[model samples]
Structure formats: structure tokens, C-alpha cells
Target: MPPTVHDRPRDDRGYPVPAITPWEDGRPQFALTDYQRSADCARQRQCSVCDVLMPRGPVWRVVGAAESAAIGAALAAGRPYRNLAPTLEGPGHRACMLYASMVCPYLARPNARRALTAEHPDELTAAVVRGAVRGALGAVVGFADYEFAVTGSRVLFRFVDVIEYLPHDNADAHLAELRAELAGHGGGPARPVG
Candidate 1:
């Protein structure tokens, strides 16, 4: 059974994305990804955005949702989540829960399917928008990917990029277009990542 969190909308996939917990500054505050995969540094650091290191942590898959009930326990104990793109990149859908939490308003919907179609699914919507927005603005610059955990009104976007991905080289103009797309959804002003 899922935890007794407040109701929220689901994405086209039927998965629910709730608002962030511990609401900060009125809006749900996302954790924002921060991968620690610096080879240049010393201590064996790993990315928190994409890697999942739990007591008996399951190997990560692209778009894999962290057990909703388990999120609090996992974080309280302190674990690292890794993006599972490399292993799960073989075919089909290319969605990640980490990726979804950030920009997909639909993912948080209770009936994502009611809002999505065969061609335009939840993840597809997120990717197209995020890829363009983040890709252009360059905030995608820091993370390979990230995770989402919500409580009452706060959202945590734990960045988890490491071995599987690298930083974007430069910002692009199409970024402006991407920002516009994102604005239509997340209830925010459209702007470039830079």
C-alpha cells in the first residue's frame, strides 16, 4: 500500500507525482540534482541524481520509480541513487522517475492516461520539453539526471548522473523554444537554462 499522502494527478502512465514535501517559499521546493562523479576529486564519490544504493537496493532502470513508501526511509538512512540508463537503454520506453519529478505536471496527475495518447505519453512529453528547455538553458549542465520525492507540498529533485552521462558542452538557441514548451505546463515562466 502507498503512504497516506495527499491526492495528486497522475501522468499518462497512471503513475502519480505528488507535490514536494516541507513546502519551501510557498512552492514545492525540488532538491535539484547534484552528481558527485568528479574523477578529479579524491574520495570515491558517486552521483546522487541517478544511482540507487539501498540496503538491498534494486538495480536502477531508466524511468524506474522509487517505491513511494520507501523514499523517506531511504533518504533518512542516506543512500546514493544512480541513473540506470546504460543497463535499461536497450529498447522500449526511455523514462526515469528521477527525470519525471522535475518537469512533468502530468506525472503527478492521478490519471495520466486520461490526459495522454498513444504517441504523446507522459515521459515523451517530459523529455521533449525538458530536453529542449534544459538542453538549451544548460541547467541540464549539472545533472546526468535526478530523482523526485514529495511530501505535502515540497518536491525533492535528487540529481543522479555519473558514469552513464556527461555534461553538455554549450548552450543553444533552440533552448528558447524548449523553455517555451515547459512554460505551457509547469506553471512557470519560460526561460533558457542559462
Candidate 2:
């Protein structure tokens, strides 16, 4: 039997959220529990066992004026500060910075470049897997270039690429699934398989 809703994890607050990746059957393999000591997660915490920095706030629900803008506009413009209810500039526009940094083949870190080091030859490279999984995820939703993070062995989502106004096409359904995955409602506490 799967864990009950009570088995779910939470944040600094007492919310019953899911683990990033639950210990399930067949999935990408990652251990999220190791970071318990390092991360500032004690309140409503469960381990991803992989040290994933998931979205701390709300799940992204992208919307646009008529269509999604490009990745550039969304992040820079704040006027839509919930002020512009529906603008073509979608969420991707705002979160592009994160992708340009985290997913880049080059040094993604903004201020400094870490040496091209630690080759995860033995198993799944978290970042690489993240990109792939996110890609498939976007395919399901009809978008691209979403910024993401991992936690509790699952891909906890914080943001989505809404620019290009594409994701908005089926925003409701897609958002629901993505949010479910991030919240650990996607499945069991299964570890990644690699």
C-alpha cells in the first residue's frame, strides 16, 4: 500500500506536501535524504535524499495575453505584477534567467564558473535528468525551457516556461499535473533508478 496523505512532507509550515521523488518502483534514481542536515528544512520536511532545492512557494500557473511571449520578456517585466492579468509575456519570460544559468552546457552559475568537474559517470547526473524530465513534461503541456529543481528524490517544480503563450493552451490540465508532481501527488516515495 502507498503512504497516506499524512505520509507526505511539508515545508517550514505545516502543509502536507509530497516528496520530490517518492520511493517508488521504476523511476530516475536519486537520494534526497542526504541534504537534511544542510538544507534549512525542519518544519514540514521529508528528504528527497538528493538535496534538491524545490520551489518554496506556489506552483506556477502560466497565463498570457493572447499567446505566450518569449522567454525574455516575462522575467524582466513586473508591471503585469498581477496588474496585467493577461499579457502575452508568459512565465518563461520571467524565469529564463534561471534556465540560462542552470541548464546551460556552459558554466551556469551567474557570478562565477565552477570548473567542469565531477563527472557522474556511474549514475544519473541530476541536472541532466532534470532537463530531460522537464523536456518530456513540457511536451505533455505544450511549452519549453522551464526552470526546475529536485527535492525528496522527485522533481519539485517552482516555475514553468509560459512565454510563447504555449503552455496556456492547456494551462489548466498541465498545471494540475505539474503541480501534482511537485507536490508528491504524482506517485509513491520511489527512488530514482538512474
Candidate 3:
């Protein structure tokens, strides 16, 4: 079975520890990307969640509604969206993506707001904080081939040839169904390729 919130390691604030999240002064900075680890994951073709080597395939990414709409529009127009828009987080296995969607405060709760800290003065953090304040309607999970791009000191993923997109209004229900399916299969990771 995929690990539950309680099953995963927790930070001082009881937040589930994301595999690739950077730690600062013993705290996980959820709003920031760990550039070195992100680069390593990209180079090694690893799942950002489980840190396992993912087979060559379309990986899963969780994005906000704005990005989803942009991608959808780009697809309808028969245009590529990768260069115009890039994701901050790396892709992961399907199970890991679902698990993160189910457990992450920002993804799971629309009312969850990211508190701005003086330490994080970057534009990315500012953007995240603004998004959180406005509230999110839901999350979109997309499967696609991705390439890494370096912008300044940050590493970003530009998704290409997206095969499918799943919009989830209720992450809890979605994850429960996924968990049940995995349980029926004797509890293993679900790998999907384009």
C-alpha cells in the first residue's frame, strides 16, 4: 500500500516529509525547490517522491488549475506549451504523485495558505505565497515526457507531449480508489508509460 500521512516521516510541524524537499535549519522549506537534488533526479530518471529509478516513460506531475488550463488551451491550439510554461517540481511515479496530492496541505486543502517568511525572498516563493492566498480550486495530474531547464540557480521541468490529464476535485477519494487498486494488486507501485 502507498504510505499514509502517518506512515511517512514528519517534520517538526507534522508535515509529511517530501523526498526532494530542501531542509534549512532543520525545517523543510516546502515553497522552495532543492536545485541539486532536482538535477540529480533529472539526471538519474528518479521519482521525486520515492527516490526510485523510474523506467523510461511519461512521468506524473501535479500542477495548479492555471497551468492545467494553459496546457489544455495549448493542446487545443495544436501548440507546444513546454517552453512557454515550466513546472517547479520534478515528476514522480503515479502512486507517489497521488500520495502527495492526497497528503500535501496546499493540494489537499483549498483553504491552506502558505505563510510568507522573511528568509524566502525569491520571486518563486512570492508567487507561491500569492497563489496560496488566492486559494486553489483543485489540482491537475498530468502524464508527460519532461526535460530539465536551468534558470539561474533553479531547476525547472518543461513537460512535452502530455498524454493525459486528470482533474481531481477531491484528492481524498481519488487517492482512496488508487490505494484500493494497489492493494488488490498486492501493494506495489503503478508505472505508466506513454
lDDT of 2 by residue, 1-194 (tens): 12233344533454333333223343321223123232232223322222233233321223222213333244346322122222111122112212222332222222222233323522333233222222211211123223333356323223333322223222233344434545667534322111
Cα misplacement distance, residue 183 of candidate 2 (Å): 34
Q: Which candidate model has the greater lDDT, 2 or 3?
A: 3
Best by lDDT: 3
TM-scores of the models, in the given order? 0.20, 0.19, 0.74
What C-alpha lDDT does candidate 3 achieve relative to the native structure?
Answer: 0.65
Could you arrange the candidates by TM-score from highest to lowest?
A: 3, 1, 2
RMSD vs true structure, all candidates: 18.9, 16.9, 4.2
Computed on alpha carbons, the lDDT of every model, listed in order, comes to 0.26, 0.28, 0.65
lDDT of 3 by residue, 95-160 (tens): 677677777766766566665542555644446554354244455455556788766677777777
Ranking by lDDT: 3, 2, 1
lDDT of 1 by residue, 1-194 (tens): 11211133344454443332113344432222111221111022222222212121111222222222233233346553343322201110011222432344332322222222223334423343322222111112223333444334222334353212111213132244334433544223212221
Off-target runs (Cα >4 Å) in candidate 2 are: 1-34, 37-71, 75-111, 116-155, 160-194
State in Å the error of residue 61, model 1.
Answer: 16
Instruction: Tell me which of candidates 1 and 3 scores higher on TM-score.
Output: 3
